[model samples]
Structures are given as structure tokens and as C-alpha cells.
Target: MVEGETIDTASLDGYVPFDSERQQAYIDAGYWRNITFHDVVDRHAEEIPDYTALVGPHRELTYAELAANSRRIAAYFVGELGLRPNERVVLQLPNCTEFLEAFVACSRVGVIPVMVLPRHRSAEANHVVDLTDARAYVVDYGRYSSGFDFVGLADDVRSSHESLEHLIAVTDGETSSVDGCDAFAEMRDERWVDKYGDEVSKTDVDPSKPGVMLLSGGTTGLPKAIPRTHNEYVFQWERMADAADVRDDWVAFPGVPIGHNASLNCIVGAALWAGATVAVEPELKPDALMAFIERVGGNYTLPMPTQILDILEHPDLDQYDLSSLEVLVSGGQKVPPRVVEEAVDRWNVGFCNIFGMAEGPLICTRPGDDVKVQANTVGRPIAPEADEIRIVETDRETEVPPGEAGELAVRGPGYFTGYFRNEKENTENFSDDGWFFTEDVLARRDDGNLEVYGRIKDTIIRGGENIYAPGIEDELVEHSKIANAALIGMPDDRLGERPAAFVELTDDATELPLKDVSSFLEERGIAVFKRPEYLEILESLPRTEVGKIEKQALKDRIVDAESK
Candidate 1:
């Protein structure tokens, strides 16, 4: 028997629930429904079978094909592999159709899919496996440009983890099984689908249970497991789709990691919820993205700030026809207002700034907003009536004056209640009253909009003056020759710490001297003390696995340069 086949739903523990009052109020407001991923797939397949659901570089899958493939894979997991309900399966594939198939398959059989990025090595992979006690890992056999052997990495993880029992390989080659590992192709084969299809179809699952585990981009240590139920996760996507004004005719291009919250839930999930097609790209190369967008009639996309900058500076940008793009959602960091303005004027596209996290409470600029608001602010909460946002003191208890800078704390129907199995973090990060501390410093504008200044830890104190990195970065990127900018505090013997800047230039031959930078800022009325004391030009900014500028890496480079 399968794990969830005979087990009681109430007996499944380890998931934290929202307060009864808040949950009830959300339900009363019709913000949440008893819906699951399986339900969404089934509904779309039955209602619009010929509609394209997923488009990758290799193939395009219709809604009917997606539903059938998911059921077949679920059958293999339950009947052939004997995966129990609630057992964790680590999915470490790139932006491909297989990732979606695996996600739906896990949902169909009541198994929890722990999404891991393709870039995760043994260190991160082992930690996730040990954290989730994952029963199986689905990896690819060097199908991407990185050329890393995912099969070998899966084997290494299996060796170190006691709970790991299966290694399913997705290969580009014709051969299915390698050694004793099962082939992903075999799971979708007609024979296996015919054999176990009915049995897997008989499996029942609860809609309110934990549906997936997303890794949090924690500032301090290894990523934490953020478990979101089917209803809450779907609510987020539906709300996002409405805000972005996405329609069934839209084609969304997701260039970022499909495992990240913004790309997974907001971009791809939102598109799918609207019955739109998702054009998946493995990487964020400017040329490839522009071509793909032109080729697929891509009407919507959400690219990070760095990616936007690259595309804006691409030499061949004019060669591609991007007129089909309707909207471009840029976030994951401070989006330069200049980029937003230029993208609108240059490409004739609508732009929305999205401020969100894996923990939840997505604040996005709507399509109807003024261009200035779309360029400057991250907009209001998705569901203003149901979501609560407060600018509070650093202690996280006292509310600050309106339009004043303070810590941002939020609570909503879509947000997660707590991190999995981590009581210390929960106690430290979440309030007893249920608000989750975002650790970001924000201020409410007089117009009732929110402006993110920077993170609490992102401040640079030079002598006694506080310098906000985003403030400087936002100004620096306006320079005609500067493509991207990041500010970090470098150690200084005189002032305890002074600000340093790492910049990617639009023209490699052009140099930005310290004097020129000082002159530029002084003309802009920037405070003298807040000016960066050191500047370094680089080919590109170092980015984290999730594509945010890695400030620590920049700091390390500064330290290494000083040491040398």
C-alpha cells in the first residue's frame, strides 16, 4: 500500500498552521479555497486540453500531455518506487519540462517535493537531504551548459544520507537506466503508465496539507525549509496574475531559476494559473532570452535587475523584435529607476516592480499605477484588506510614526507561519502575535506606498554617519557609462569602516576615477561623508545562487585586494 493510501490526514504532523482567527477570516473573505496542484492540472487538462501549458527549449507540452505525464510519473513513484506519502523527494533539475512533471507527480501522490536549484553542489545538496530526510533524489545527467555530472552528485548524496533510497536520472541520451539507478524516461514510458495508471489515479490527497518545501534565502546560514500548503501557494500566484493583468493569451518567459519563489510561484505559477504558456530558459543570457521572446511571442516576463541591465546593454538588443512583450516585472533587488524609465521608453513595455520573498507577502506595482510609482515604489500589498503591513521599530514591537523608516513586519493569508523544525529561528524571526519580520528597512510614503531603503544589515557606517547602500546604488546606476552597481563597507583604520563600490561598466574601455565619481555625486547633492572612498570596476557583479548581488563576495574581493 502507498503511504498516504490508508493513513489518517490528521495524523500527519510537523506542519504549523495559522492562527484560527486569521485563517477563518481569510476563508470568510474567499481569499483561500480548498485547492491543490493536482486539482489545477486536472481542471486545465479537462477544460482546455489543447492549450499549451509548458514550453522549453526542447519541447512544448500541452495541458493534456502535462496531466497525463504527471499521472504516469506519480504511478511510478507509488507502485514501482514505493514512495510513501509525505516522504521528501529532492528535485534538482534546471528550467525544463521535467521539473514541472516531477512537481506535479509528487503532488498527485501526496509526496512533498523539496525544490533545489541545479547549481547546488554536494554541500548544499547534502544539507537539504539531511534536513528533509529525503527518500529520493531526481537529477539530470549533465544536460546543461554547466557540464556538472548530476548523476555522480546524486550518488554522492545517496552515499552520505541514510534516508535516501532512490536515484532517478534524467538523461539526454537514449539509454534509460544507468547501473542500478532508474531512468526518468522509463517513468513516463507507456508500459509503466498502462501498468500503474489506475492505481495511482485512485490515490487521494488533502488540499490543505503541506504541498511543497521551498528553500529560504536566509541571510545568515544555510537555507531553511519553508513549507507552503497548496491553498496558500496557489492564492499567491492567483493574486499575482491578477495584479500583473496576465491573460490566457499571454506567454510568460521565466529566465531565472525555476526553483526560486519569484520565478516558481510568481512567474511560472501565475502564468499557469491564468492558463498561459510558460517559455522556460535555462539561463539568463541576453541574446538567447531576446531571441526566445521574439520566437515565442512572449508577452510577459520577470527578470532580475542584473538581467535587465545586461539586456539593456546588449549590443544585439536592436536585432531582436521584443515588441510582443507587454510587461516586464523586475525585482529581487533594488531596481534602478533609470532602467525602469528607459525600458518603458525604449521598448514600449509596461514595467512593474515586485518586492517579495519566499516567506510571503508579495508587494507589487500594478499595471494601472502611474509610471513614477511603478519606477520608484514596490507598490502596495497584494490583498490590502487581508494583508497587514506595519513599519515598526527595530525591536519589532512598537509601531513607528507614519512615513518614517523602520523595520517591516507583515502577516497575510499567503505567508508561511514558521520554518520547518527550526524553533530558534521561529522564535527570533516571528512575533507571538503572528507577524513575520522581513528584516528589511522600509518607509511608508505619504501616498500610502512602501519604499524599501535597504536591509537592516545593509547599512554602512562611515565614522558616525550612516550610508544606505541602496541609496547610493540607485543613484550610481543612473550614470550613462555604468551598467550595474553594488555598495559594500570596507574596513578602514581611521573611520572603523568606509564605503566601497563595485561597478560593472557599460563600456569596458571607459574608466571611472574616484574623482569623477565624487564629482558626479557632489553634483547630485549627495552627502560628502556618504560618498564611497574606494571604487573598482569589474566585468560583472558576483551573484548568489538565486541571482542577487553577493555583497559578501564583493567584500571578500576588497579584503583580498588589500591583503595583496
Candidate 2:
């Protein structure tokens, strides 16, 4: 299932059936362009030595500076600490300069870096660290609430997994901070020179070899590991960059965490791959992100739906200087068209609706897509290989009509090789015929545009009638009072599972009446059956590691509340 092995040169000629023939230019150029992410970094360091690679409020690292620091870190990882290729190095830090250093360093030296989201507490962290059999774990000693101690977490990981040995603490040492644990400053040594430097410069760097281990959010079970190689990553980046219309001078403001595919695949790599500047914002909070964007002189921004709503509703949003932001790319959640419409109409910016998951298709807005499609539609397949990519009938295994909603199954060059070493799960995830079932429902509009319906798994069977959640949530976000909305099915004694709307409200939410939501949806012609039977208001809806609305968490909260 490796990209190099599975996808032959001949098979790729007609690979992208859904895409225009113009996309062949990218593959023709990158086909044998075979360079690891590390190779790109090393090339950039030498070529664009003085250019600012990353800029943030906390620190600024140039291409040469970031590469130098990463080399020192790579030395510590390989020389003193004895890290090896194919070994798992768990990175559990928020968006910061350190994450970039460690992640790029690992890629350079070929040690597999598994991204550990900052939201994971000790228990959840331990579960993933244990499952991955990670040799080392990296974290910020003093970060966030919960008094999340790096030393304590390290000890817990060591106890849980016999393979765990190193626990590198960033920030705080003697002349620098920390007692027993290794100081991050020691690894950041300036004197260290490149040793496995060929690993970075060599064109022979195996793109088929495993490079990153992206963890599933444990939605169905404990998160399964998916290994992405260098070549597959190249394909992913080309497709994403193509979709985003990334130019050499384009600057990207990554609102999503860099570790996740949204930022890493599109923002980080797109910048490097296209020779553009990237502004790494710390949090998705509206003010902070826009402030960071102001400082970095950004041209492009990729914010989620809620983050957009926050900006649209922010009291002092008008104060920020966002005239430099030429493009706004939104993904990782369903975008309510109205929220996007308001932002576009008011802020004078067009919305790019990107839809896809880590394990499969990456549908995003392209240059040729109409303004309505760019704002309203998710998009068509952007891959050079798409043997099967469509919304098909769930009841009969038949391809649904263009406008009908059904499951999305696809297989292409950008698709993951397979889940990391999970044979049984891999067999089940992909169909026997070979298409990777996305478990998402989508509709192909009459104009050849694609609109995401909702998660097929998230479908609420209310009294045997299926109510897709995204359609309902989309209408819910249209109201001025609502910030974010998620609909989850709850067990009804009469109906198998009834749709429940879990909502997060804006600051001015107090004034809106309950009927306002229902009336708005009804006027828009949203079916009565799709209307939620219950509405739960919260400060915020729980999110997965990828920042997706955690409907399962809402379901648990409802059950817990009902039990009490």
C-alpha cells in the first residue's frame, strides 16, 4: 500500500479523473522530485538563508536560524541520547517555536514524530504514549492549567511503557533550569554542526519510507496510528497547495495547530514547498490570532468556523489591520454558509471551504471554482490519483445521483499507505474493491460543485428517519447569537436515537429567544424532521485533538446529566 509501490508511473497518467489535465504539471515536476521534508528544509536554509521562515509574538526563527537550531536538536537526538530512525518520538506541546524545531529536526534525521495535542491530559497522554511505545516524550514544563508537570508526566509514561526512556523538558534549567531531566537549552546548543547532514541534502531520501505517525482521535477505538512517508507527503502538499492557490510570495497564517494535517499539510509545507513565508499563530482565539497576523504581515489565513465567528462578533475586531489577508481558508469542521457569508459580506473576504480527513480525500477550493462554490461548496477531488472518489448510495453500494447524499469512498496517491502496522483495521477501513470509505456524506451539485452533508456515522436515526447533523448545525450557526453548534443523537425511548443540538453561544447570546433558532431554520426551508428535539447550551462544545466538535463528548455529558 506504500505510495511508491502501489502507484506506478503508468497508472498516474489518468489518475485524477475528477481533476483537470492541468494538474499533471505538478506530478510531472514532482514525480521524481523525490525529496524528504528535511531535504526541503536544508535547501531552504542554504537558498533563502536570510528569509524569515517562521514569525510569532514569542520568537522569530529564520530559515538558516531554524535549520541551525534543528541541527543541534537533531545531534542531541541522535548522538548523546541515541535516538534512531523508525522510532517514535511523542511531541506534546502547543503551537510554538519549539514544536517547529523538534518536528523539523526529527524529519531531518528520520525519527518518527507523533504529534501529541496539548489538550491531552496525563491519562490520555499516557494512553497514546503507551500504545505508540514511544522512546521519548517532549513537552513544555510550564504550560496551560492542570499544573501539567513535565517531570511527572515523564515518570508516568516510563512506568506505563517499558520502552519509554527519555523525557526532555523544554524551558527551565540551572544556568538555564531543571534538575534530573535534560535541559532544552543543552539541545539548542549553537556550537553543534551537522553530522547526518547528507540525510537532509540527499535526493535519495526515501519518500516511501515512514516519516510521520498521525494518530486517529480514538473516535471508534483507541486512536490508530497512520504513518505517512516522504513521497505521499509530497503528493499531499502539491494537491493542498494547488487547492489553496499558493504562490511563491504568499504568506500563510496557520490558526490550526501545526502538528495536525490542516496546518502541517497545507500551511507549513505549502509555505516551504512553494517558497513562501508562514506566520504561526499560537491559539485559535480571535484577538490573539489576528494580533499575530498583524505582526507577521500575513496574506493568507486558515481559521476554523468558530474562530471566524469569534472575529465576526468580536467587539474590537474592527481595530485589527487585516487588509494584508488576501485569502481565508477554513477547514477541519463543517462551515455554516451564513457565518461565512456574513464574514465575506462584511469583512470583504472570500471563504475557501476545504473538507477531508487525515486518512483520505483532501477536497478544497481551486482557482477555477466559482465564488459561490468557493464559499459554499467543500470542493472536488484534488489528487492526481482518484480511482474511486464519490458520494454513493448507502443502502445499495450504488453511486448516487449527482445531487444525492451518500458515503464518500476514495483511493489515490495522497491517501495514506495504511494505518501503521494495523492489518485488520486497514482491511476494514478500505473497501474490498480498494476505495477508502470516508464515512462522510456529500452531495454533488448540478454545477459540478461538492457540498458536504455531514458524517454518515453522525447521522441521527430519529424514529427511523435519518437526520444529517451538518444540515441542522449549518442553520443553527446562521443566527447572530450562536457561535458554534453540534448535533448528536441521544437515545429516545420511542425513537432509536433523537437529534440533540449542543450549542456554544456568543457574548451577546442572552438577548436571543429560544424560538429564534427554530424560526430561522424553518424560514430557510430546513425540514422539521431535521430540527433538534433538545438543545443544550454550554460555554463551549468539547473538541477532539484536531479541534473538530466532539459530538461523542456531548453525548456523554447528556447521559451524565440524565443519570443525575
Provide backbone clash counts, one per model. Answer: 0, 6
Per-residue lDDT tens digits for candidate 2, residues 1-564, read 112222222321211121223234435655425667777777888998888877755678888988888888887786667766667899877677778788888876667788776666676678777667788888777632325675677777777788888887777333465655666767887544455433333312345566777766534446667677676677677666776777767777678777677777777777777767777655667788778777777777777777787688788988998777766778777887776677667756656678867675778776455666776898777663542476678743688988888888776556764676567776766665457777788888897778887777888998888888887887787777887888889888987887788888877766445566678888989888777777878887887644578777888888998899
Which lDDT values do the candidates have, in the order given?
0.84, 0.71
Across residues 484-516, which tens digit of lDDT does each residue of candidate 1 receive? 889999999989789898898886448889888
Provide the TM-score for each candidate, comma-separated.
Answer: 0.94, 0.86
Pairs of colliding residues, candidate 1: none
Candidate 1 deviation (Cα RMSD): 2.3
Off by over 4 Å in 1: 1-14, 142-144, 190-194, 197-199, 218-220, 492-495, 561-564
Q: Which portions of model 2 miss their true places by more than 4 Å?
A: 1-32, 143-147, 172-177, 190-205, 218-221, 367-369, 384-388, 395-397, 479-483, 504-520, 537-540, 543-547
Weakest lDDT window of 10 consecutive positions for candidate 1: 3-12
Q: Cα deviation of 112 in candidate 1 (Å)?
A: 1.2
Q: List the residue pairs that clash in candidate 2.
A: 172-177, 173-176, 173-177, 173-178, 174-177, 207-231
